[model samples]
Target: MESTAIGLWGVPLAILAGAIRVSTPFIFVSLGETITERSGRINLGLEGTLVFGAMTAYAVAVMTGSPWLGVLAAMATGAVFGTIHGWICKWPKVNDIAIGIAMMQFGLGLAFFLGKAFIKPAAPHLPSIPFGAWSSYPQIQAALNINVLFIIGAVLAVLLWWAFRNTRMGLILRVVGDSTDAARAIGINPDRIRLLATAVGGSLAAVGGAYLSLYYPGSWNEGISSGQGLMAVALVIFARWNPIGCFLAALLFGGAGALGPALQSVGVSEGYYLFYAAPYVMTLVIMIITSSPTRSLSGAPGALSITK
Candidate 1:
């Protein structure tokens, strides 16, 4: 009986560990998307930016022997991608969504092309705080060996949440998202605001990519992202465009993502591949539950196309 109880507890504990490990990317990407969406722009090309960021980060870390500098390089790369997207989207009759898709392809191609040589080269790893040092269990210690990016992401969420509600810049972003006409009437340059927002968003998303290469999987490859950037878009919707909500939603999705592996570890593996789809299924279900054709979801930006 005691063994059974312990086994049951292990599942949840493992799930929590999974959440901690997996939520970092979600946190960074979703928050970046939040910033872009709030400025009445959407960049589906974040998928590309993420891949490129990962490649750049890995390459920089390997050459410089500094993970932090690699992170900065990734941010710069992401910003450049965002600037290109912003510049092109400003053209008349340009479709941001289509451009995003194109960018995604371009990013993937570039990453694969440049990262081909980096496949075998090892890079310096990011630092992690040992919160589980007090625990005697190895599993607990492993679980607590989380990267610093997680804490930074959490802090950014809280700060963004407060800024969105209390800061002048946040109000301007909200107004722009709600109505370009309103923003113009108030002397705000909607296009400029959106461009800046997208740049910042791209930088943040790249930070998540840095985390992937410098920490988690800790390698350079074409398959580093695995749709994490795209999933983050849906996560933003489920989070109702709130930065704090994005953080919580990320943790939940991260846990669901870890479910398949956790179950397989304890000798229960009936549908291994199918278990991997848990996160997508959860996203679809949540979309259905939260969506309304007649009314906009709570916290959605009015001018954003995704909500409609």
Candidate 2:
């Protein structure tokens, strides 16, 4: 009876740890998407960028035996992908969303083509901070191996939140996103701002991909990313374009993701595969709840087509 009670208590605690673990990628990806969407551009090709980033990071780490170099390589690749999306979108009559989808296909193809040789290679893993070193339990230690990207992502979110409100550059970005005419009146180039924003967003999203390959799953393959990239798009909407909200929402998603495994551990094994859909289900539910068919949701940039 005592063991049964202890198991029940442990379930929630395990879920919390799982939330922290699973949320890291969402946090990074959603934050990256937030920046792009804030600039009135959307990169649906982030899925491709993410997978390619994972491939690049893993390949570089394996070749150089340094995980940090892998991260740099991933960032560079992501930037290139973003630049491509931006460059193409600058053409008249080109749809940014469609271009994004195309980029996704391009990214995936490139990743698979280049990553064919890296399928069997072993790579150095990212270093984790020992937050649970004081604990004697193995589960505690496992949880403590929290990735550095998680901390960096948290700090980045706070910095971005502050920048959006208090920085000159951020103001310009807002102007561009809200209205191209307004940006032109202020001597700002809307195209340039959006281009830069998309590039940065791509770079950040790649970092999330790097985290997945070099840390969590700690491997590389065509399948490294499931629907994480697409799900991040939905997360950006649920967060209402708030970086802080992105963090919290990602944690909730992570917890939802962990539900199946956590439940399995306690002898509840039915519907295991279905648990994977919990995050998506939650995202859809939130979108329905917050959506306004008649009026745009609050804080949405006026120039964004997604809100329309």
Estimated TM-score for each candidate: 0.95, 0.95
For model 2, residues 1-308, the per-residue Cα lDDT tens digits are 53355556567867877888788888888888888889888889999999999999999999999999999999999999998898889778889889989999999999999999999988999988989899666566665668898899889999999999899988988888888799899799888888898899999999989999999888898888888888888888888899999998888999999888888877887887688789889878977877777887788888886765
Worst 10 residues of 1 by lDDT: 1-10
Per residue, candidate 1 scores C-alpha lDDT tens digits across 147-181 of 89999999999999999999999999999999989
- Shift in Å, residue 175, candidate 2: 0.9
Candidate 1: stretches off by over 4 Å: 1-6, 290-292
Question: What residue pairs are clashing in model 2?
Answer: none
- Taking every candidate in turn, the Cα RMSD to the unseen true structure, in Å, is 2.2, 2.0
